[model samples]
Target chain A: MKSFLQPEQWTMAAASHWLLVTTVLLSVMACSSVPAPVAELAAAEQAILTAEQARVNTYAASELAQARQKLQDARAAVVQKDMLQASRLAQQSKLDAELALARAGAAEALAVNDEMKKSTEILQQEMLRNQTGVKP
Target chain B: MNYLKRSAPTAVAAAMSLMLLGACASKPATPEGVINARQQLNKLQASADLAVLAPVAIRQADAAVQEAEKPTKDQALSDHLVFIADRKVNIAWAQAQDKHAQDQRKLLTDARDAARLDSRTREADLARSDASVARNDAERARDEAVAARTAAEQERMAAEQARSGAEQDRLAAEQARNAAALSQQEAESANAKAAALQAQIAALNAKTTERGLVVTLGDVLFDTAQSNLKASSSSHLANLAAFLKSYPERGVIIEGHSDSVGDEDYNFGLSQRRADSVQGYLLGQGIAASRITTAGKGESLPVAGNDNASGRQQNRRGEVIITDAVTASN
Candidate 1:
């Protein structure tokens, strides 16, 4: 039983070693051929930073969180030596951060518009009272 | 077994060298992006509005900061996490501010509605008060009109009373004036009657005495020593009868007288017969018999002495006396 097992084990070990070598060679080749997603990562980081300055974290919290998660996925892809996936994730993160900033501005403007509408209602009531000669 | 021992020592040496190289490459200093993200997170958490209105957002921002602070070999990935964390913190602060402004607008709207209701209630109260005043004024005017009518009625009654009194006074004055005029007319008529009676007595050659009116017939009115009246002297007796007829309220007295030439007894008889004759003649001429009385006077009541013819002539005569209603009683 030992003599039979030793041959099979040696064959298994040789196969594992060849697979390991092939995986390492493929990883090296992929790293050498693909460019780093440095520009896309920088754009995603700059967009999220601009959203923070514009108060998007509070007004568009869900969108800002989604942008942050996409940027993290992009960094993980870079570490895995998948430059195409990393660049795609970084671009998506930049667009998501820009959307979060626009949503924050839109929400703030909507709140302002609601307040202005209430003021106009009060002004109209005062004018009616004056026209009718009713004391206030 | 010999190949495994040799390979194991080689793997151990490689592992140790690899660990040393990793130690040299690792960054111990905190990244500037991570520090800025932490500061932003702390500012959001400290806000009073973020704790209540934006609690969920603040918690999300805190989680992002923690993720950003995690150690990583990739510098680009660490910077990206820090940027997202800062944006999350700003989102919490903006939500809190917007909510506060909305509450203020609601408060102003409520105040405006309350003021409008109060103004309408005041206007209704003023209208009710004015209506009450108008009703009172109308009632006063009606009362005044009633009072004026009562006063006019009283004045009319007073005027009626005054007119009745004046009419009574005028009737009394008219009655008194009529009585005075009647008395004056009666007095004047009585005076005229008295004057006409005096003229009739004068035409008979009568003299008024204390007793009545007296008329004398001379001796020539009769024949000498005769009892009969002559026709030429009958006119005097007729005129006397007419005066007696006109004055029916009078009575007459007859007297006879003679001269002394005759015997005493015979002369008395002749004087009596002569007086009777004159009275009988007056009665035949329409004088009431009850209005005459007769008497004779012989030598005892002669007007002259028998010595002279003129004296004897005057002594032979007949006389008549008429008595008024007042003198006849005596």
Candidate 2:
């Protein structure tokens, strides 16, 4: 809170202002060159939410956990201002979440197929028995 | 040289940036994950078994693969899309498998039902055929039994007829045998009578000659060519008469023969007188006149040669012959 209006303090303020402006300009240029991964992060979050909604915890628990970890990594990359790495991690998270959702869907389909197969087998055996005049 | 030295770091930084941008621009020709997703989608589309059953799933997988294969600046985004697409393809494949299995099971069930129905139909047909065969067999057996019974009845009737015929034949044969025996008895009785007659005739020294039963009175009985028979000859004539009377059906012939001792006419007259004398003696013994015949053989019918006295005496004879019934009737 000391007065910076003295001649020596004024020279120090001028050098500091020049350095701060250069740093701001460089930061602005870097921000313009590398955009934020806002869309990818949102997509990853939506995918993870969808995986959870689809009961991936039961069918693809490991994949869902990996997706959540990847999503956390993407957020850390965003905090570190690593736009490219953030984008990559968000994408990886989205992919993992999608994979988890797909695995859940596949598991559900496989379970249904197994049940159908069992029913079909029983039906076939019963039909065979009937045809052969054997007791069912 | 100083300018070169001053621009070296910038040049290197520019080159590195260029290389980085080049790497970013020149992406992998095809992402393996996306390619794999595309291949799985293609396979799902190609499946005909699941076309109708999982049409929606196949369409979704195809859409997801197309999305995944899209060129993007973010490789991770591409990978993520590819992963989702691959999973979608897997989901589509799973759905297709499930539906395909269900359809196969349905088809098997239908076939099994049809087979059961066919088996039942065949069994029913066999049963009907067996029933028809049984009926035919029963009918045939009944017919055979009826035919057998009829044959047995006919045989029994034939046997009865044969028995009656045999009985009749036996009675007829017995009657014939009885008649034969009666005839044989009659013949034996006749033979016995004939034998008795022959015995009586033998007592008179009678002999069976070609003419008939002949009782000869030698020249001794005629008394030296006299026409009259001697007393010894009367016994022979008496026996002949008695035989002739017993056999009324018989007749008698009185034959006289002489030796060649005189003229032929005188010998013939002597023979006739001797035959008439024998016939008169038989008539006196109660033999009917009709039952007697007389003949005279002159010296031509001499019984012996006239070379000596004994031969001439033997030739002079009076014979009484009993004729058969046939000759008598004639």
Candidate 3:
């Protein structure tokens, strides 16, 4: 007994299989391509985070330096027998140092939260593309 | 069926390419952006609150500082100092009043002492004046007593002389009576003459008024301004004395007068001398000196005016005014 399927039908079925295999490979390649830029973007984001932390630390250090200078001036005024001016300067210096330290902590928290939100948005877009087999 | 089978793979390939492109284009929102937007909203709210309250707060602070400094700079401190000074002035015034009262008391005491001394001096002077007046009165009384005693002594001496003269006349009358008895006709003539004299004496005693005999010697009694009696005036006085001797109780007054022709003082002296001459003749005839009073009333009491010689002769005549007691005794 001989086979009944034609040679052209066999060629078409083989081409279809080849196309599915190529799409799967391309998708994986696209997914692999995302890691190089994503890795570079993550490094850039990390650098930006370090720069922001440095700016916050510099602001905190500058405020602490100004507070220390003011405290010294207030002590000098007290030595000169000017209690009213000394008390006002001491209170202003303490409030400015505390506000600068709080603002530095808030900037560091905002940087870390921004990095997590970018990573989650990339993951959710990948999931939606896999389930629908369509463009976003 | 053939056409559907020919387009199915191509459609799936296109859908897969679109899904991959969409996945690559998606971007995520960051927390830094959300926080920056919230901070900007809070800064706007703060600016609005500051705009509402700034002008009112500045005005309130300025007022509070001004009120705190007002009490230390007031301007009336000098008036308070003056009020305190017046208390010391009042004390000085009280002391001055006390000193003035003491001075017044001393002045009054001195005035009283002066008045007492003046009164004592006046009383001493009055006592001396009264003693001088009393001495003058005593001297006047002594002079009056001496005059009265001299008048009484003169009367006593004249009465003694008249008694002695009367005894002598009695002896002479007795001798005349004896001589007349020797001749009878002579004795009868003497008795008749004695009887006539006795009747004249009785008639003088019967009269109660003033009475006396007026014998006018006329111009034959004396020369001009001379007090001598002529021999003819003497004989008439002798007869009058003889008649007066029979009546011892009868008194005689001899007076002289002068015309208004000479000085009144000289006429008075001439009249007094003429009266004394007549008194002397009566004494020679043995008339008692105690029974005669001699006086001169100078040309003052005149019976006639001195315009004619007859009137002047009448004014120059003498007069005798005998007292009633003497006539009654005669």
- Which candidate gets the maximum DockQ versus the true structure? 2
TM-score of chain B of 3: 0.35
| lDDT tens digits, residue span B1-330, model 1 | 999887998989999998998888865455568787677667766766546766887787788778878877667776667766766666656655555555655755565555545545545555665577778888888888888888878877777777777777777777777767767776776677677777778778998887567788887678888999888878888788888888888888887888888798888778888889988998898877788888787767887777999988888888788877524733
Ranking by lDDT: 2, 1, 3
Candidate 2 residue-wise lDDT, B1-330, digit = tens: 999999999999999998998887775455667887787777767767666677887787788788887777777677767766876777677667666765565666666566556656656766787799899999999999999999999999999999999999999999999989998999999899879887877776878877667778888778765888788867666777777777788887787889998898989889999999888887788878887788888888877889999899999988777778726622
lDDT of 1 by residue, A31-134 (tens): 58776666676677767767877887777898889888998887777667777778868876876787687568657766665766666566567656655766
For model 3, how does the per-residue alpha-carbon lDDT over B234-311 read when each residue is reduced to its tens digit?
A: 655665576567656667777787778788988788778888888887787777777878888778867789888877
TM-score of chain A of each: 0.70, 0.67, 0.44
In candidate 1, stretches whose alpha carbon ends up further than 4 angstroms from where it belongs are A1-136, B1-187, B261-269, B297-299, B326-330
Candidate 2 segments exceeding 4 Å error: A1-136, B1-32, B46-53, B66-84, B94-201, B207-214, B218-234, B245-250, B255-290, B295-318, B322-330
Kindly give the stretch of ten consecutive residues in candidate 3 chain B with the minimal lDDT sum: B83-92
* All candidates: DockQ: 0.05, 0.08, 0.00
Q: Rate the local accuracy (lDDT) of all candidates.
A: 0.73, 0.75, 0.51
Per-residue CA lDDT of model 3 for A1-136, tens digit only, reads 0022234434564456335434543454455542122222222222223333446455356655554565556545444444444454554344334434444544444444545455445545544453454422
lDDT for each residue of candidate 2 in A16-63, tens digit (9 for 90 to 100): 633543454356457677666766776777677667767889988998
Report clash pairs, candidate 1: A52-B87, A57-B87, A57-B88, A57-B91, A58-B91, A58-B92
- lDDT at B184, model 1: 72
Q: After aligning candidate 1 to the native by TM-score, how far in Å is the CA of A8 from where it should be? A: 81
